[model samples]
Target: MAMAITCMLRHAVTTSCYENPANGSTSYFKTLTPVYYPPNGDCSDFYVPISIDYEQPEFNPKFKWTDSFGLQSFMAALTARASAPVPEQAPFVNAKQFKGDYEIAASFCTPRKPNGNEKKVIVATHGIGPGRTHWNSPFKPEEFNFVQYALSKGYSVFFYDRLGCGASSKADGFELSLETAKAVLKTLVKSVKEGKYTGKIKAEKVALLSFSFGSFTTHKAISEEPDLADAIILTGFSNNITGINGNGLLRSFVPRIANIENSARFGDRDDGYLAWPSVFDLIMNYFKAPAFAPSTALFTQSAIETFTLSELLTFAAPANISAEKWDKPALHLTGELDYIVCDGQCKGIIETPAKEMYPNAKPLQVSIQPAASHHLNFATNATGAYGVITDFLDAN
Candidate 1:
């Protein structure tokens, strides 16, 4: 109670309202403020400090593929990696109560012209490769930025860096699991609802827009809290609970130490923070060509962000598979060629599982954006995919 009250009383970040897209009436700013928590914001005491403890892989970053006798052999430890990992096959840690004055580096924005959707807010969670900028890309904003697109369409956005990334508070990477990530997200949702950290936007409707691991975090959140979202859109997602695609994702990511791969940008981060070794790794895992532009793929060399190994180790095969009480609308958008989740084809593989997971969600729709990969926003036809998402949000 004390922590929540303290955080509540703390002054919100000060910054100018968003005005760049001059015609629209919204505003913008970046700030780090305290993020308090509950295990489940609706069910638990919202004021309690939340601590999440879960099993984690003992997979040390220092150990090479060779150290495990080979990459193939190391795969055995995580052989059962899926939506709900087979316990024996997992490589991990083990234990939750909640405690923390965590902080998030967040950017809040609203639409300019008053429209039916201006009060609607999308809480976006980016995948491993980008930060909050994934939604508001500085690189060719018009063609690829979802944030600018949403604002232009008369909606609001609350985007932020996940803990241990960008300007957000950094923690021991090994201790940062998806459970903790989900709790952080839930806390942020509560604050966003109260207009606490987000420049007091006081959103009328809140939707969850998630990609890749962020999608996993969203799934975890809704599994227990049905009321967490009004609408949910998951891109770069699939119900890969079983050993899907021969474990192609982990092999491609090849988890390299961030500092070793790009010392300049990641040298300050700890060893647990990981980055893929090369553009090839990203291309293999996140991009599909000739569907995507070469320049865009090349641009990823700069856009790439480091993520934690613990997140990967803990994300798959969630214990709870259903969001029975969530009767809202859902859009499961993925690239037809999303190699990571769909294993290069989305139609048959991704649809049914997503449907099964959100069985109670009314008007649940699964869309496979043609010619794109896991990085849907970076695709050549990204705007097309973005349209599908925004349209769903508007209608639902």
Candidate 2:
């Protein structure tokens, strides 16, 4: 079951179980008896070398934010250029292939005891927020942890930081395009399915899960390599280009050059990386009042990470494509009040993407979790969303 993978895992991160999904209360759902995660000796941390010769756009990362007006102008131009095809008339006008080994940090975990669903695993990639921790949150694990929920349901979880975030190797931000993101994810899927870590996930049935920005990368990877995963669940995202308020949400970031804004955390990065300058601005982009706890917001700020300029310049372009080549199961789940994706009303808007993006999902499903925002895991009603995710897995 060997594949195009090269990496070694580090010491197990969990010798003991920290949280149980059954601890939380929800009238609609119930979890199984808790099991010690990692099962005595299991691999947790990893650094995989992803080598790809991907074509990336050319851009001059020389703009300086002189004032708010300057920021608005830059955003407007960025959005405009992102929509244009490669060989864009002016900005990002040319393309060239950049290939190398990028060391990506990953965490793999499974239940100590096996069940009917044991070999089934979910490989998740996070959005622009935190890193892999977005799915395995630390502030309140019972209420916020997706890995715990999946584990209780007898499924393993493979989570990783994207190429240029967290403990992963940092490179020229412009080199980290959507294509690169797709390549990294595809390789990870093969690694998990082929049992790169342990026999636990080797040849296992895999599900690809993505949040917000990571959703597009998942969408692209599956389209290019149709059978990489058995099921696809895109949370905190949709292909509704018209309804998604990306510009407004991005402007709310008050995006600052990552190194300039928070030198302490992002100083290692260059001007090609960007981050939100304020905590509240990020809140407005992701959360809805009373739907989330204050501590959740604070935890999110503490975990915030930087994104790249190339990523921003290429995000909008993929919103227009559907997974036409895929004939497997697919689901698009999101929060009803996702301020960033739906502009605060996702009721009627969520259904359009089901037809447009995943028309070939053997039996495509869409779940609009009530009273939540883009950051579904951080919501007070998070487990409810997690239930819908697992239920889809259970059925498909």
Per-residue accuracy of model 1 over 203-321 as CA lDDT, tens digit each: 88899999988988898788788788888898887775652454566667787667556665666667667777667777888888887777666555455667876677666656236
Model 1 vs. true fold: TM:
0.78
- lDDT for model 2, on a 0 to 1 scale? 0.72
Q: Candidate 1, which segments miss by more than 4 Å at Cα?
A: 1-90, 96-99
Residue 365's lDDT within candidate 2 is 90
For model 2, how does the per-residue alpha-carbon lDDT over 1-396 read when each residue is reduced to its tens digit?
Answer: 011011012211321222221222111000111111323224366777677677766665445444446555667665554656533323464677778787887878777665777788889999886787787654556778888778778887888888888778788865677878887888888878878854545646889999988988888788788889999999877787888666566567677777666665666776667887666877888899889987677667766778865676566567767689889889888999998778898999879766877777887898898899889988889999999999998988
lDDT accuracy of residue 253 in candidate 2: 63
lDDT of each: 0.68, 0.72
- Total clashes in model 1, counting residue pairs 3 or more apart in sequence or in different chains: 24
- Which portions of model 2 show Cα errors greater than 4 Å? 1-43, 61-90
